[model samples]
Target chain A: MSTNDPYDFSARERDILRIVVGHIIPASAAYGLPGADDGAILADILRSAWREGRKLHEAAAEIDAASGGTFATIPTGEQATVLQRFREQHPGLARACEVVTARCYYRDDRVMRSIGMEVRPPFPLGFAVEPSELDLLEPVRQRGKIYRDAN
Target chain B: MVEVNEAVDVVIVGAGASAAAFAWSLAETGMRILCVEQGDWVKADSFPSVGRDWEERAATDFAISPNVRRRPEDYPVNDADSPIAVANFNGVGGGTMLYAAHFPRLHPSDFRVKTLDGVADDWPVDYATLEPFFALNDEKMGVSSLAGDPAYPPKPQVMPPIPMGRSGVTIGRAMNKLGWHWWPSDAAITTQTYAGRAPCINLGQCGSGCAQGAKASTDVTYWPEAMRERVEVRTHCRVSRVETDENNRATGVYYYDGDNIERFQPAEIVVMASNGVGTPRLLLNSASERFPNGLANSSGLVGKNLMLHPYAQVRGYFDEPMDGYRGPHICTWSMQFYETDPSRDFVRGYSYQFSRGHGPVTAAVNGMADGLIPWGEGHHEAFRSVFDHSAGMVSICEDLPEEINSVTLDPNLRDSNGIPAPKLTYRLSENTRRMLDHSVARGREILTAAGARHITSRSPLPYAGWHLMGTARMGTDPRRSVVNEWGRSHDVKNLFVIDGSVFVTSGGVNPTSTIQALALYFADQVKSRIYDLFD
Candidate 1:
């Protein structure tokens, strides 16, 4: 369901989530890495399972309450502080958010490219790896019949 | 609903690993063989690889545990009482559909556990007896590995080994530093094109049903050839129970068709290749007036002595990016600690398999579970640091047969067919716990020596019951075992059990190779003693 649904999330709750997830994975210009807010990852976060979506919205509301209804207006560092406090109070919810955020972010084309990987399914044309040198296994070959003999 | 009663020379239940091996072995005999499987043939194109959500699909459509997949063809299993959950696929290839295809032969010492270590009972047959079958199956399945592994006897032949990714190289260096015996893995995935199957493309999704047909799952390796040989495999036919005659001999089986219609298939010989748990559950459900306790369970040990390999894993984070997601999931392993040592508190031992880290989704989930990446700020940094920089290893430790840990019909739970669901009641013994702790500790040391910045070690995953064994053991003594050395039922002359359920002791390595070998060996026995089998 859309975040506009009253039972799911209000406009204020959506804004707060954007701020919270942004701090969780802030854009790193130095590393050229896209953060949680980039590539519509926040939208992906909002599209989680109903139970997890509710948890995320409730967690956002909790953050707003903790930040005195200014979670979105607060500075990024301050937002991180409030989110960390919420995490301490609700570790499970925090983990849920982290899992959703990481899962979505890594699948993003921009994120995958930044990490030097093709943004595609690993099939049809799977990646290649160089075969190992046989000499590398010389030690194991020298140690003969490691298994005990049957009596 | 349509019903049919047909008689065949041989009726094999469950078209899984053992069943495929047995059917292929007996195909040359020109006997009328019929295999009834509950699940449909899984097409290669339907594999997860073609989808963008391949990894996610693995947790859903291609999940190893039937309880999670909930496919129409799968039966539910009640595993709440057990610490080690049973994870098996129900399709034509069975568990091989989702197996990692790591095919390691059981150690010779694994056969004589009682004779050598005074623990579990010795296998009725020794490793030497099954070596040729192992070679045959390996050749047919296109096993890939280096030639000179000191851990094994001289094998017939093998394809070139798969690439050892950076993770494997790191683990190999650590093993060398420790002077431990490590070798390239013996895998069922083809390294070069063989038997029309393409070489592995290194998708790193071997557990998600290989789409390229590179993985040697029985659906591709045996079922096709067996079908060509005129062995009839009836899909979507779930065998409910093995029917017995008034003389207490197994005659055939009662099954539910795709339309949920009941039907009977009569046969001169009935083979149970439905795995450790499924085999026992079927036998227990087939209780009749002639064999009240269960079919071929005159010793009252049909569902007793369950053995699930107690597994544990350790992940090491290296400073450099290992590109740990680039190759086969399991490409290297070490048997340095495979042999039992008096110094160790445990009786049997374990083998260590080196793994490149999981795919992106699994890595993300695992990272959160390990608390390596916390929720708030710097989460991205933590995730990035661990993403491609980790190498891992799994220790498949041997679990002894204990009568207390068993598969029984759940009193309340039932499957789609209204048959009682199999309930697994299991707990780690003190001995197993000690062994797990030891393996984890050893794993940590290896990672530490390998220049790991950090390491995460834990007990076995609940879903690590991939190697199910020893539910209905085989032995010479009819008073103590359900089946004879030839896998024939001791009480019923024509009944046979050709699966891991006939294992006397759970070996430290994966049981698929041994399971196929034993099935082929028993099929040979059936051919040699055709006259004796009927009498």
Candidate 2:
């Protein structure tokens, strides 16, 4: 159960994860999004994924073995094929990776601003939503009391 | 050796919503009041909203379900057998700390479900009697709403309503088109500055514990004011059981302090303001030679008549982007579907509580779970599709009291203090199932009218047992009830329960407002008869 066990990721495992995550959320210039392999995001994802401990190490080994030890050096299309097969074979591993990666990705300040959100936290300066039309209640006002009284 | 503290005039258990109001009200009588709370005061700044991992924190740390949160102060409640889980907060403000602040009062008919709908037992007290207490609580707790709704008798309010945003406008327009009754919701969060607390800045973080001090958790609203009036509160102290004298009169409580050392705090009067589950657990654990079945359980109804308001959550996705997470997501609700209809399949109906769909993290998590958002390629696309464009309502269905759905101590499981954990054994009734189906269908209608492209719903929402009530109900019949009309234990004249545990029927609305009002009313009754309170 210790995260700092011998089952911690190897150097080869880290390289495989880098290539795998890049495919999970590849860079999108059109959406102005960074791939999950982006330096800081990848590190954050791996740090968070460290909690998965042996599960992560085992998944990385399985993913690497599926690509014939060339997952870190596979072509983009071949990598996708390998990942798809791995996902089908090991659904839990795919989910663990996706959860860690997406958690780090969405919370990134760059990603938040790209999606039209304020970079800062919710408090101190919260958003000011436009005031809705109070006149909308006019029709309901005309409808009149809808409650029942038993007493 | 168990430390014995000096005897106080009064000792209230659990400094949550009910205890806060009761302590504040009874403080006026100049009696020495001490409230023992298991959880410490929550630092709002330490809330999840202050960090980038706010969503993650909310889902895990500030989670509404105590089973999920599992903080040191929280005791586990085994809910594996129940469809709806137990949701509660153990801190100074209790459930208010993590509530959505959607404040709504129970209707007049809610008090007389048995007579009006021919289901459940009727409350010994009625809305007319508790009306003044509700009004006073509104002013004291800083209620914000428009008062002219025809839903009930005219209500007097002090503040204007919270902004509905585009989400509210769309929902309102849709309801108006359907000719259903809807109104701006009453929120406990402040719209304008009151009692020195800041106004809501629309953080949309009320559910994760409001950092802006806008949402009125009793920790901020009542405790501070009560302390100024000389009411004392001991935090991080869990009450093990209430003690009774040879005459069957209440004496005090046995509790574990911050260091987990057992101690006895004696009192002249004992008030049980613990939430529905905790109140019953304590009373039952207090069984003595005189009352072996359970203290104040002469009618054997102490842990009976449990009602966890069965909830139905329905979300509709719109094509156009709408205002999302502005603040106080529950800004308005519809009572059109409230009240019993003889034609419907259920005895009582439910109110539709509307809100913006999800925050960024929650959206991604839910989308991933639903298989709509993928890991590779078009992950961003699926997120954008449902992120801001989705809106929904939670049909707050009224749960009729049933003795079968109850909370009893597990034979094996225990808290860190070795106290038995309450095991919730609840099952959704057939009436609730039909009511949820109809509510879901009606919800789709409203969302479609508002131009939603698609709709999704989770009936009898699994993680939505937020409104715990009716385990120990109030009635005049001593053989079938636990407490009397004034919330005093019928068997033990000196004991009182002023929490949701005393509710007779689970109304189709959040019970925090009604719970506080009842606490105030019970305090008033106790004061009026102070000369012979034990009699």
Candidate 3:
């Protein structure tokens, strides 16, 4: 997989990922900048793959080929459907997302935070609170609300 | 009747920095000199052109080849062919051909380390004695630096200093805001059109053999001038042993020529400027029946009290374009807090050097990730923005000498020549580990202040191959050191070892400038016949 080439996502995968990352690190519509869902973050991650000597294009192509349709062709609704099916049908995507979300958050979050975008959430199954008390950043606690405050 | 070989006045081993300086100085005396180099001759044109995105030579060990770089079976530290942990340049100027050209002198207190911080033993000679030699070395090397920089000790530079770029300016401002001391770094590069050489063009490829001849890599400066004076530089000749007589007076050396055949060359005096690791290994290999241990092991200090400069790195990603990977490898430094403070955990201090960020290829491997939808238009956009938005700095630290951190020959392993391999058994001191932790935290703070998007760093540890020094130190006492103040071994009269191996303590500063100055001083002592004073 050549990490340098732009990932040719199926329409469905593109729509879902773009929307997911936009919401993960939501972009400010008031700033006149493109929303995080504009696919900039995904493209940048693919470019980083190339820098790392990986074939992002090939990896994407394999996923596309396995889905029996190009990733760019699938709709966001279909991408969400295929991903849920992917969780049941294929083990690779499930394992890959498990690792990628945990690792890329620290490295990729800086730019997202700078531009007022939140990284998209991944694998909600692993999101349980730890036994210890949570220590959230002040700005995050005040501004970033993941769920409705019970109070 | 046996024929007597032609006698050279002085035979120097290893055509590295010190050897080149010694050759140039001795050539001025009109003495017949022969320099045997294990490497080939390299010229400025030999370097890869700047226009190309180049890969380093595999032989130079710059790439990531796990098997080829260091073979664990034959050599524990490195490979059989390149067994020593030290970086090797098998060309005209040795490793100086690929150095980053960041040259800072060890302070006066660095020499008297034992007295100041109460750590290692003090040098036989003080900074005052070697100050004149330092000026001579600076003048000869065409060092570019400025005076009145409060960050470092008091020493004037001969040439005008290089301009600090945007990254240096940003880092400098941030350091000041945080109450840290910083200054324009002293470099061994020609900043102006001085001595018929062009000034640095800021290609940022100084580590990979400068093609412009602006960087002082001995070949274009001292070695060429020495050649003009009729000094014979025999390249591709590896000196195996420095042969001595029954009376313990120096004779000459036996070396393998370009061919595998061995040849014996006789000379009056022998000088070994073959770097820190190689010099000690050569000495240990020169064990004769008369000298039961090694050539200069009367005090059993031939290869004891080894030291290495432990370094840590901090990388920052900034919003504004820093243009960091565009200038010289090093042009700015922070030496304001160079003196030892008892409040700090470490006995000695460390200097923070602002240097080149990772190039494109390495950054992708280290910076980018898969989570952001690797399959699409998003990947291309991320690649373009991050390349220009990165900045980084390095911490050049001082490591106190420990007797346990010694270089011994591996009993079971051997090189291609069937020679025993040098085994480096070194671990970081508790003080050094603590120092690294402090420096990394400080670096993180600086990056955050500079508005870094995110910062990441490895825990502080001793990295191999930046600046290795002090395997064989210099002192008056035979039991404490291997060489005297002039770099001549105390046990042997005519055998001199001029290199970083003669450093008494691994100062926080880079040792190249001091190494060159000490080499010039050793040459002066030899030329003026100052042995009478010593006797």
Name every residue pair that clashes in candidate 2.
A145-B150
Please list all clashing residue pairs in model 1, or write none if there are none.
Answer: none
Residue B62 in candidate 1 has what lDDT?
86
iRMSD computed for candidate 1:
2.2
DockQ of each: 0.52, 0.60, 0.03
| Per-residue lDDT of candidate 1, residues A58-99 (tens digit) | 677677789898878878778778877888898887776666
Full-model lDDT, candidate 2: 0.86
Ordered from best to worst DockQ, the candidate numbers read: 2, 1, 3
Q: What's the C-alpha lDDT at position B162 in model 2? A: 90
Q: Write the per-residue lDDT of candidate 1 for residues B1-535, one digit (tens) a residue.
A: 4365768999999999999999999999999999999999998888887766676677777888888788998889888988888899998999999999999999888899889989879888999999999999999888998887888877855798888878888889889899998888999999888999999998888998898899999999999999999999999999989988788778899899898899989998999999999999999999888888878889989988898998999999888988557778997998878888999888788899999877676776788778887654555678778888899899998898889989999899888989888999898988889888988999999999999998998797788888878888999999989999999999988899999999999888999999999999999999998776766
Docking class of 2: medium
Q: What tier of docking accuracy does candidate 1 attain?
A: medium
Task: Kindly list the per-residue Cα lDDT of model 2 for residues B417-516, writing each as its tens digit.
Answer: 9998898888888988998899999999999999998788888889988888988889999898999888899988888999999999988899999999
Arranged by TM-score, best first? 2, 1, 3
User: What's the count of clashing pairs in each model shown?
Assistant: 0, 1, 36
Every prediction: chain A TM-score: 0.81, 0.77, 0.38
TM-score: model 3, chain A? 0.38
Error of 2 at A19 (Å): 6.1
